[model samples]
Target chain A: MTIDASMRDALLGAVPSLRAFAISLSGNVDRADDLVQETLVRALSHIDSFQPGTNLNAWLFTILRNLFHSEYRKRRREVEDADGVYAARLSTQPEQGARLDLEDFKTALARLPPDQREVLLLVGASGFSYEEAAEICQCAVGTIKSRVNRARTRLAQLLAVESVDDLGPDDQTRAALQATG
Target chain B: MAQKRAREVAEDVVPGHVPPAPPRLDRNAQARLGEQLRAMYDDLLQQPIPDRFIDLLKDLDDIEKGKSTGKGTTG
Candidate 1:
């Protein structure tokens, strides 16, 4: 079906966030771009199936996620670099401390199981509610919550975070930790 | 009262009656992790999207129009 102008515009707007999700999911930019391109093509082709005025982002995310599970997951496992190669290749900003911490976090995130990682990105980083994430993942809301909880716990373990107090003197970090804790 | 007291004592003597405390994550550590995750996500978002994607979208649009106009169809 032909994509209308407004739908096309909306799809364009979702690209950046979609790319971010793809990157986090795939851990490789080139692969992520391919996934984004695939998602777009599929989205455009199936535009008619999309119910108008609903949550387009969620719908798009579901499509991308299904594609990841069906195709990308197996291919990614075969060539997955366990040594932080792709993450190291990422461009870093001038703020060395924050950049280093972000790198560490990304490494930790990569270590998580795909299921946990997807939930973490959806509910934690992507700002989707439990219900929304559950819908996207095709699981129960409780499952999403548990996955997020496990993802956080595993990330903390992987990062060797002994205690919240040991996270240094960043108050915002402290507050965020407390909320999660 | 004597029988109730005996049952209470038996319950106390049962093995594995008390549960262990849940492991306490350092709040600061969790917050730091959360903050770092947010930063990473934000950084990912800031990365420039490749031009190929935009070009692909345009191509798809053209293809759709082409189909409607009875031009050579491209999938």
Candidate 2:
């Protein structure tokens, strides 16, 4: 099911969700939007590759995730992840004392050593099954599980959350996360 | 001090499940959270699509069409 005439608006309509997912992945709105734009262009160009009835969101996410890693690799030398630059930049404003702790989350997430973060974001946040994430990340299923578990543990420590439950309480956010998780 | 740090860390990680606060999403709080997320999404969706991106797509389509023509011409 290519993104032909009927699917154009429908696919494009996934932009908000895609953008939100990108922000979750990238940490900021601007970068997330850029990622969405890139994903759209790529998806449209390779429209034939997209099956009509399959999960368009998941497919688009796979593309965006791949592009993010590629871009991250290209800028590996020039940009430093040091002292949580990427994480810090991704942090959203906290709400009074009820802040989302974006910095801590970002730092923790960023420190996840790409492989784990990739798996976690895909499996934990993005709602991709371990199988799907494995396929996307090009790793074995067990590897994806380990990465997710490890990522969860690491995030727990970073966010200082006692358990994963702590992070999953935001209903809307959780719902959003579950779609990709 | 140690306990304070631990508590703070625990609170930070736990969204609404900590002992100090119930995890229930009050309508007001839920509304606020929704507003925040919506605001963020709205801001993003409203962003001007970069001209370069638009241009890039046009170029790609043209090239693809050109390739198709070449194949037909040769065939």
Highest lDDT scorer: 1
Residue lDDT tens for model 1, A1-181: 4586677778888888899899898777777888889998898878899888789999999999999888855766787656665445444334476467676778788888778899888877777778888899987665665567667788988888766444466666554433332
Residue pairs that clash (backbone atoms under 3 angstroms), model 1: A164-B26, A164-B28, A164-B29, A177-B30, A177-B31
lDDT of 2 by residue, B1-75 (tens): 698446545543555533343244333333333333344445545655555454655565567677777888753
Tens-digit lDDT track for model 1 on B1-75? 697445434443555543222354566666767777778888878877678877877786787677777975467
Residue lDDT tens for model 2, A1-181: 3333356556656665677567766666677778878888888878888776787877887898898888877877777666666676665455445445434455667666777666656655545787787677665665565455555555555555533333334666444433334
lDDT of 1: 0.75
Interface C-alpha RMSD, model 2: 10.6
The deviation in Å at residue A17 for candidate 1 is: 0.9
| Whole-model lDDT per candidate | 0.75, 0.61
Q: Score chain A of each prediction against the true chain A by TM-score and list the results.
A: 0.81, 0.78
Q: Please give the interface root mean square deviation for model 1, in Å.
A: 7.4
